[model samples]
Target: MTKLFIATTALATVLTGAAAAETIGVSIPAATHGWAGALNYHAERTIARLEEAHPDLDFVLATTPDSATQVSDLEDMMATRGIDALVVLPFESEPLTGPIKRIADSGTWVTVVDRGLAQEGIQNLYVAGDNASFGSTAGEYFAENLDEGAKVVVMRGIPSTVDNERVAGFEGAIEGSGIEVVAMDHGNWNRDTAFTLMQDWLSRFPEIDAVWAADDDMAVGALAAIEQAGRIDEMFVVGGAGMKEMVARIAEGDETVPVNVTYPPAMISTAIEMTVLGLTSGAPMTGDFIISSELITQENAEDFYFEDSPY
Candidate 1:
């Protein structure tokens, strides 16, 4: 009778453990750009850590180049994988909304990172960096450092809500500051295009005081053009998205690229962790998770430095 009771208890424990293990699907945009590449890196690392910590839980990672493909990917993941939860960094907002909403309606937990969905009341959680604050901080820095009336050039990223918010914030901060924006152009968040645009701007506006590229990759190209032109006096460049190389510049007090604002790619990790907590610990995480942006300068560069990071 005692042996039978022990055996029954062991079987019950096994069944409980099996029921606790949940499968999570993580879908993100492909690593076509530096920021997305960094997102992939952080997502992979978070998965590894979470899996080791909770041996029963399983994680699936998927990436696509565009929104339509990502929508398809999400559907396939749901149909074939039997995912209990989802963590997504959408490529774009509109095309992804319907498919993601469908997944949410199927009772799978959803955590949306960075780009938000067009349709509301779907995602269980939302995570993102403060993009508007990123631009506003940079603009404030430029205004304080330069004379009251400075001519500046702006290089924009892809035409998304994120880009528009940053531009609006920067312009709002500098309003009535006596700073004139000499030229503004879309760089498509590409280094080559930014370099070409900066070179053209230099030729067009000889009295430009500074360059703000909104992101580090474009800032690198702009920096290269400024170097090649041999125009270093009273010229400054600012960028965001805490790329390692740009953070290093801040640490070294590089005058030309003196400062940066952070929109770290690691926000994906935050989303994943939150989703896990929501599923396993009954944590109430069903709300927007907006991360803060900070200015990176020589005094505070070490805090943002990650030696092993790819971006």
Candidate 2:
């Protein structure tokens, strides 16, 4: 956990000239779920747009399905590609830290997106959504909607710093509010897994009043499960991320999915854009840029919906 801050003045030397040919390596997770699919879509779009604008700049985008593949892909980029900079959205924190840090040590400027490496000082710039706000926002919604002493279940995503931050934010917001969290489990941010988890919840908890699905995919799964069990009338579910389907539900006034929180996958665009700017803008992009999470309700669900989006 070393703190190696990049000074603004020092980055000017690393900056590539606008007219010169430059290469950037981008590593991201493969589209494993709804949010990640949107993330990949935005990354590819950004890469295409940037290439169109800066003909001299080449972006080498690689998507990995797991940490091992991500690590190997990054290594390949370092060895074969003459990349001046790297934009990485780590597949997993701990496993990818060493390879990512190696890129930095090789004198390539690094911009990390979404999930951060376990070790600090590995990347010069960091960008991600507000996991704390993501959690607490949904928790507040549950607190307001549910009756006092109501039984609630929580479905968590994969284990990571983001997951911990979100769960902490949620529990912090609902503490002592009489909204008892009767059960909590991992959904792994996958629809099928979340559906199975929700199915189990239905079988076990006969009188559950509400559920906080920490992600949009999980919320969709939970809704499907509740419908199958014919308990849609009993519990209201809260999910994060402004997924098109979930937003549609909110817009349609589907009581089963009462509300949602915003955690858009488009933040990858910001990280990629910033990385490109850092390379050619002759300025420092050497700090944290955290995207905030906001609540999505039926009153403004249309604002969050994108009809063409796959997620």
TM-score of each: 0.93, 0.88
The lDDT of model 1 is 0.87
Report the C-alpha lDDT of model 2 over 113-203, residue by residue, as the tens digit: 8887889888899999999999999888878777789999999998877899999999998987889999999998888999999999899
* Deviation (Å) of 143 in candidate 2: 1.6
Residue 285 C-alpha lDDT in model 2? 86
Following a full C-alpha superposition, what root-mean-square deviation does model 1 have from the true structure?
A: 6.1
Tell me, by lDDT, which candidate is best: 1
Runs with alpha carbons beyond 4 Å of true place in candidate 1: 1-18
For all candidates, the clash counts are 0, 0
Give one digit per residue, the lDDT tens place, for model 1 in 1-311: 22442353356448776465577889999888788888989998998899789766777788898888888888877886678999998888888888899999989999999888998889989999988898899989987887877899999998889999999989988888899998999998889999999989888887889999999989999988888888876599998898999999889989988999999899999999999998889969899999988899999999999888888
Candidate 2 wrong stretches, greater than 4 Å: 1-19
Which ten contiguous residues of candidate 2 have the minimum total lDDT? Answer: 1-10
